[model samples]
Target: MLQKKLMLLGGLRYLLPVIEEAHNLGVYVITADYLPNNFAHRYSDEYCNVSIIDKDAVLAKARELKIDGILAHAVDPGVVSAAYVAEKMGLPFQCSYEAACILQDKSLFREFLTEHGFNTPKAKGYENIEDALNDVDYFNWPVIVKPVDSAGSKGVTKVEDKSKLREAIETAISSSYSRHFIIEDFLDKVGAQSSADIFTVDGKLVYATYSDQLFDPDAANPYTPAIEIWPSSMEQKFQDDLTAQLQRLFDLLHVKSGIYNVESRVCSNGKAYIMEVSPRGGGNRIAELQDMATGQNLIQNEIKKALGMPLDNITAPEYKGVWCNYILHSNKQGTLASLEFDQEFQSKYIRDVGLIVKNGDQIVPFTGANSSLGTLFLRFDTREELDSTLNRISDYIHINLR
Candidate 1:
């Protein structure tokens, strides 16, 4: 039997599980990116030097690698490239290359949603800061400005006044690789936003789950979510409706087998809207958390889909507990900080914690997913326990910084 070959675009840490699993299954995994020191490369069978964002270059490299399949899970910059390579090489793809292009670009996505009559925010894309500033007066207050192609909330901001539009636009443009940005109506969060991970097999959704995405008002970036609680608080009817809408969207776009990380909301307007639909796994190990809660390995299914292996794990999710993943970060820059929890805290509720930072390590202010300190997984027996614990988190959790 030949060792199956797999190519992973972009060497992000989140790709580690895919590489390890492939290795365990006796598959030869090749990791690719311009950076030689990206941590994921340390675990791959081979490392290839190539820019993941350049689709043509990546396709050429993939063909040269003679790999069986390709994936860009948890790496937004590599999604289009992965799709392009797979489409060109007659391998499996998450969606059509054209659909990938529409999904990857914020401007294009918003336009498509509106044109297709989806529940969407009023948004406009701009390449000219001056033009955006001139048109800023047209939008309502508290509009969100963000880079069109960037993810992890790198350059997302909410502006309350016209005075801040130029600054926000500059920040977004600086953070964007393509120097394009979008300004959109900011829907008032009614309860909590929803960010979820769902799986599809053979152009059909197989499993779906969402979480109530919570934010910290005092974080360096107020828009960045501080935590996520699984089994969303949204009414079951809305969840079902959102699932139908998402399935419709995929069907219309002809999305194929893989995982989708979606950001959406059931807002103050009493309408559910999808803010983003990226055909890849999410940051913060959302799929991993789902696996932990449901005893199903979406990572395996995602890898199998991309690599043309038999789909064995696709099934309706059977949840076990109410879980949450804390997006740990500091509101200020610091060094030599201590994260301590009460003695009873761990025994009572804390399931697992991975503090990515160490004592005396320089910590950046909470800005986006890139600045996340680590992930803390917690499980509770009931919704009340989960809510109470999260509501008074500072009581049991301490962050002492110098």
Candidate 2:
């Protein structure tokens, strides 16, 4: 019984539920990048002419497609070449390649979470902006300068003083591909770090999910995290203290099988600051709204944890429901002429409605999360009918720009 040959790298729009849960568990998906109309390459089955930071042309096309599984769930420039083809085909990845180069080098993941203190958020790593203006008095007024590597929040900024901190560290070190730049110390905190997104196989945590933060009050200055909502509102003793600090950080970075995706934050005085850790998964449409709110396929459990199997025999579907995603930002730089959502104001909690760019497709002003143009995938069954179907679909959508 061996028909699992998966290899997915980059494709915007959260790799469409890892290519529809690895083609509904039969697993033989393939999706390399260089954007050929990327929306998970229209539900991948195969397509690789590579280029997502081509790590040896994606390990020579995953060893000329022997591919028994090696993934890069939702883009981070293809998670270090899908952990270097699961470290040259040994497989079962989620760390190693030196913890995927300390989680894709956000200044070595904030110095490995500030040397294990873990509640980190007073950061500062820079390949010069005069070492962030000599630690800019250790940090104070509205600070955050991101791009120690880059992600959806491409370049991320927010600097309340010193005349905008040298153009926000030269636009976060010129959009760092690794030129480095990170400047934190601005956890004014409301909530934007509920990406637990776990799933380990040999190392056990068997599937888990939680992602929240879908805000946009005019894209809230230097704050980032514009949209994403899932099974979290952030309080269950702060997700059991972020599941005991991410199970002691994947047991001190061993990370057993595939998919890790941790990001953390919770400080209205509760204090829980992980801030980043991405093996992969959760970009937009968060694993397709976590498999439409917990059916738990996660791309055939990341192809049965890259074929080692044993995720306690996969049944998962208790179904409470409350998935949400909404991002329509444009503050100027426009084109898209229409995008209206209401659908009789509530087609039983609408499951999807994407407006993925068209009508000229220019719009790019809302900075972070790569200026998401449209999305809204609510599902309901509780959280007060998903907040009354997101306030009656925000009084029926009307997102026109021009």
Candidate 3:
């Protein structure tokens, strides 16, 4: 066994790659989270029962274990806390606690970009309906309102009228931790946009993959991602330009190591507006999808970067493939009596069936992808195969609710 011990602060869903790579590398992995049944904990050698938000407790535990390096790859909430432990222990961490805070919080990030002269959408942050309404004149209608810290499209609302502004602000603030919500001028979704996931070693770019989002405009609520497909169908130049912009941002931010997910949009005129940056890999099934489209093992590279080890060269695979994650959701809130997936589908490219909501569990009223029943991850050898499978899966699967 390796002498180095590594500590991870997120659950299995986020730490799947970290745990797998660390254990494979012969390092002792310690998984910590609030939930006892978290996915990653099941695969780890040792599990710690603690809340991800409890920074002091986590730091104390790290001291006891003498962890060589700490990481929070896909977990945004724990990134700052992870850096806290690294800073206190004088370990080599990628980003500072202040930088992590700015990246994790949308309001702070917007301000940072504005001050830094990075391309940004006009925006404002509010704590309540009154504050939001007081600044209503500052924003154009159809503004984007969302929780400053929430991810995966939770508590995102697009306000089109003055009457609905207060309600949107209330909903956004309710879902946030700091009672803060960001209201930004909605950008035109013309042309193309993609979420670029990149890895850097010693502040230099190593690997990258771009995923195109299938935006659902008329899905009642506007804050859902709906579906995301890898190696976006966009033109090659668009991808290269966006990558260049991200390279600049990475340099400016002084990203030493680990993964970074930058959500950017290519305007109709070809300008790329950076949406946000996370000092970690993307959530949902992005990492898994990237692996399918490209032969590169991102999870392995991320671990090597965090441990200060040299990573193998990462390149896009020769074959073209598509990986899609469909968010299953319902219009109403009720008891989730039962859930089932087609057996044939499971045996095929369908990787696994995961249900965040279980039988007899009460489902809440949700407007977007945040309240999904579960995620359906599909991989295919070709785009044609991917499209055909998506159509078939759409018709065959069922999410029975009561």
TM-score of each: 0.97, 0.31, 0.88
- Residue range 69-104, candidate 1, lDDT tens digits: 898888999999998888999999889899999999
Comparing 1 with 3 on lDDT, the higher-scoring candidate is 1
- Cα-lDDT of candidate 1: 0.87
Full-model lDDT, candidate 3: 0.74
Worst 10-residue stretch by lDDT in candidate 2? 311-320
Question: What are the lDDT scores of the predictions, listed in order?
Answer: 0.87, 0.72, 0.74
Task: Please give the lDDT score for candidate 2.
Answer: 0.72
Name the better of 2 and 3 by lDDT. 3
lDDT of 2 by residue, 249-356 (tens): 778887777666677778776787778878876576566556666766565666677666665454423455666777666666768787666666547666777666
Question: Candidate 3's residue-wise lDDT over 353-402, tens digit each?
Answer: 55577788887644654466767777767778876876676455766678
* Clash totals in order: 1, 1, 1
